[model samples]
Target chain A: MTSVLGPLALATSTGALLIVPLAPALRELISKRDAGPLVTRKDDGNISSFAASLRTRCISLHRMLDDCAKFGDNQLIDLSHGSAFVVGQSGAWAGSHHPVALVACAGSVELPAGFQSIADFYCRGNVRCGQQSIFRSLLSEEEIALGNDTQVLRWVHAESSLSAGRNCRLYGRASSAKLLTLSPGCSFERIYAPVIYSSTEGTALNLRTEYAPYARLAQSGIGRTRVHGAMHFPADEEHRGDAVATRNIDLEQGACIFGSMKANGDISLKERAEVHGSLVSTKRIHISSGCFVKGPIIAEREVIIDSGVQVGLPGTPTTVSAPLIHLAPGSVLHGTAWAKTEGRVGD
Target chain B: MLLGLFTAVVALICIYTIRHYCFTVNRIIGQQRHPYVDVDTAEWPPVTVLIAAHNEEAVVGDILTALLEVDYPAEKLAIVPVNDRSVDRTREIIDSFVVHYPGRITPFHRTGGRAGKAAALKDAMAYVNTEIMLVFDADYVPGKALIRQLVAPFFDPEVGSVMGRVVPLNVGKKLLTRILDLERSGGYQVDQQARMNLHFVPQYGGTVAGIRKSALDEIGGWNENTLAEDTDLTYRMLLAGWKTVYENRAECYEEVPERWPVRVRQIMRWAKGHNQAMVGYSALLLRSRNVSWWERFDGLLLLGVYMMAPVLLLGWLLAMVLFYLGAPVGGGLAVLGLAAFTTLGNFAAFFEIAAAARLDGSRARIQLLPLTFLGFTVSAISVSRAAWQQFTSWIRGQEMVWHKTERSRVAPVVLEKSA
Candidate 1:
């Protein structure tokens, strides 16, 4: 028995080396497999780019240029003469050189066409440029004052002190500017450049201004109808009043609506509800299976989007903002969403 | 031959300990990936709450009062207090609540029945007509928002049951209760939440849980013969392709056994029931086609929880015998390595409890974790004795009796103070 035990114990002791590490390895493998998909940081670049691309489709640069042209006092013709050129006021060019310059003396400057000659451009107040519109330095000022020994265009206040090598730069301490191309290398002080529009902060739907009036209208009992089935309204009835429900707005399955709705309580949109307008709720919003909302959905509490439900219109994307947002499996969201707390995508 | 068997057993214990530690560590890491968010819904569904009691007169009144104060629509909520042949004043307290709230409180009196919680729940199921049913033991005191939180998971169609976190109401009463509180935190806050986050099985601990009526009906109701009906039903639900989630935010206060003997009896019952479940459902779980391989593996581990006590006892006994006989258990390095692994396994519980306390913002409770070893030793002894008793009962072909743990009548005083 002693001889048998000695060999057996020897074999068992040697087996510990193989057995000890095997359990943890197996556990790690199981844990890795069970952890499901890795939760990555929400790609802010993708979301901003998507929003920018969608906004670009909504408003074209040509339309913006046309609007700017209506407000420009002096149109830039050519910039082959000097770097700083003034329209009406006399100002000196302070810095290096400007290939093409269009200084709006009286009002703002609108570069409708491509002006490639100007390397550094300055405007007195506002400047609007379209896509493929190039310049070196785009500055907007109230009054471009030229100092002693500075080159100045008479009645055209222009300062050419800042240098522009190879990149495009917008230099100014102004309020707003509508620019077509805002690349990563472009620098600006304070201007409303559409290309750099990425934040959803100021773009959030104003609940007080845009949505509270509907609730007030609902309370006043104007154009309110308890919708039991499908209903269609003309464009005249779009902003007439909200269809308000006191308790819950239960849109039955296959119900279609062409107007907006407001509910003091919860709102449940059943499957295949073809809604063409906004849905405002003071409480929760539950969009059931296969529902389509062509407008924005603003809720004071939670928002649950069921599977196969589509939000946002065809060309125009809307926003769904709430404290908690739950996107069920297979749901298609064509717009932006903001959850103040957190958002759950799937199970 | 004896030496070889002892070595193999110690090696198995080491492997088991390491696996358990790895599971906890992996769960802690996995929690970062999937964080839990409280469910907020617009509409509240109709719910039926069942309180199963057997001679719980001291606590039933307070539990009933707490249930009435839940923050849900009165019209949509239904409370059913199952008086399962209690010879005390439990029926009178339930009747008084029924008289006060005529339609909301529905008293279920079972005079002649199988005389266990499972039998009572099955009997109560006949009267339930709501979409969701929440169960609470007689000693639990649910918060106002607990009902809403408990029923929130049923909104997901795939979820069959939802388990809430339990806190000890008598935690400051004694050292034993304080240790149990830490154990409860380790078990629920860290272990259960990690399992849920990792997609493993999170148990539905008989109390403070919500079950879908249809799901319960589909699983043929609770098994009456099993000692651990919760474990039995948990495995049954997983096999039927339904998910059970753990909601750590949904917390309720429960009274734990403050005395050592009572705690031992409570643990013995849990051990017997859990082992009985292992024996009854291990083969079915292993052969089930619905669950995944990893799920089957985890389910087996969860079922074998009660067996660890005896395994631990055996290891201790073997080490002592080897020390007395002047034999090196393994060589110095081997013994040292095994000791490190065992220490790590033991520390796993402390780590989990500390993390849970930190998560709960109850950082002061973490200082009391060293006292948990007393509770662990008691549990080990009770589990081993229960295992031996079960083995002898099986050998003698005798039936096991359902022994209920006695409750202290200090519940009213605790409730008044909390209120």
Candidate 2:
């Protein structure tokens, strides 16, 4: 028996060493699964999603005003963040940050004074925020009017037309169902509507329309990148194909590009220049007055649209997106204006 | 003669190992380029999503229901579900969706076809009326904003194809699934993305990808003969001077295989189909002047991905043969080691998976990295066998039949939610 024990010991040691190769697999078997959630949707960055989420987890009038009502549903309910005040009458009043204002559909409620709101505000009818008022978010069923020196932290959405006043910071996404207007001295991140008026519409040379005098417009070869790494399209030229450049692309005034334009460096469309397709640039994109882009205009750094410029035709909206967007008083955009960092109303 | 063969094998093996190592390093410290990711507010073009299903009754209805609620404009977006000779109730379910969502879901039922996804997609191409066509498997679940994200790249005329990341739904079902999950992360998060940054090849994996209609027409539609139409289309697009863009942030959930037999069949079919492309276009891709130098080099390497498994297996077999004949095998062990390491990755690497885990921020189950050795060994054998079969069938003038991964769902109500 003692002699047999020697052979058994040798076999057992060999078996144990072989099992070492399977250590990781064994550990995986005994441990809990460590997979992440499969369908974690990303932040699509829209305003309607906020309203949809709130509608799903909503409260009844009875439960919402259960504790605050000494009389009717017009009273204010106390919340964890602050108080929810239901304004039953329509009038201009000084706003408070501690109360979540819920305006009644009876009339428009204008909060033209100053306030800092720490809670989410919901309104059924048209509403206006006060000057220098800081808000988390505002979801209005009707139109919205932001007063001067106002700042919104997350988002603001309205069902009807919306307009912004001077010296306001409309951060995150500000969307309206109809027209959206921005006054001078105001900055924004993203603004969307059917028709967006960034500044006063001014008369300028039209880029979208065909310039007269076919004799002056020579057909451009669509500007090739030269050995020095710059692309320059001669003035009063037209290209039927896309213009691609590895470096800076300067289109002379009155040049007409019927195709897409892409540049690794800055893209400068001179005054009266026209681009019928999208403009994708790695750096800055500046379009001078009377110039127009029919498609989306995207830039990695900043995009400046000077006065009298219109992007995307009415009812057929496009996008002008950049980290910083500067639009002069006379510029207009059809669809969305996205400024990832800061968007100024006036250049 | 034997030494020359061994040297050639070792050279191929070394090339692949070096390729993966470079992928790991570049993805770790490289400037990741997702140029099109920030394109959110564009004038989105009209798109038609094609869902090709064969006996997909268990999962068809939910995808239709989920697709109807996407963020795209109601008038511009449409869904076409191609029913490819399913004897099951797949057609009935698709018809039901058609009745429910009048102009939303268009049913393209094919009673007789060549019996493959490529054939189904080819037949349904006539029904597509939009410039951008997006494909999804019946088992896939897309997010609300996925359609918009997929269509964003077409704004650039140079972009011909667009691909997105695929995440496994039933990840915790068993050990096989957990390993597959890691592989998915590594393939998309590291390898594909790095290729995109370096201006190399980014493959358009059939599902959860978008293709320009005009580009597809130029390439002469889908190649219906091959089992891997996605890889074939990728190579064809590369040769035509068209770019295949990768979007890592556009994550879509899919049902991966849970059982071992199912997984083996999946990889084997991939091997046979991929080698077919390698044989068809390896010379043309290398000699093509339409693409850049980097494109040709990396495109050749990508075409050889599935073939590496069998090539590595052959290396091990050669090492054994040399040992029996008393031949000197100094660098042969290095060859064999590198070959074995190919399958030991989430897709193909020891370091690639680690980088992916770090990038994706999912580090809980990384302890299971060693278990991949076994999974890869099995894959090597299966791939080698399939490669041999492909050669033999080509010599005998036989057609390669299509194989599908069998799937079952435990939850019936959760449509867009992962299984």
Error (Å) of candidate 2 at residue B402 is 2.9
lDDT of each: 0.61, 0.77
Lowest lDDT sum, 10 consecutive residues, model 2 chain B, at B410-419
Cα lDDT of model 2 by residue, B185-273, tens digit: 77888889999888799999999999988789888999999999999999998887677989888888888888899999999998888
Q: Which ten residues in a row have the lowest lDDT in candidate 1 chain B?
A: B33-42
User: How far out, in Å, is residue A167 in model 2?
Assistant: 5.8
lDDT of 1 by residue, B1-419 (tens): 54565576667666666655655676556533122232232235689999989999989998888888877889988999989989999899899988888887989989997867898899999879886899999988887778877875553444679899887776665667667877887788778887776667889899999897767877889899877788888988888766688887788888888788898888888888899989988999999876767778878988988887787667556555665665655444444544665566677767777777666656445565555666777888899999999999999998777767788755373443432
Which candidate ranks first by TM-score, i.e. highest?
Answer: 2
Can you give the lDDT of residue B225 in candidate 1?
83
The count of residue-pair clashes in candidate 1 stands at: 21
On a 0 to 100 scale, what is the lDDT of residue B376 in model 2? 78
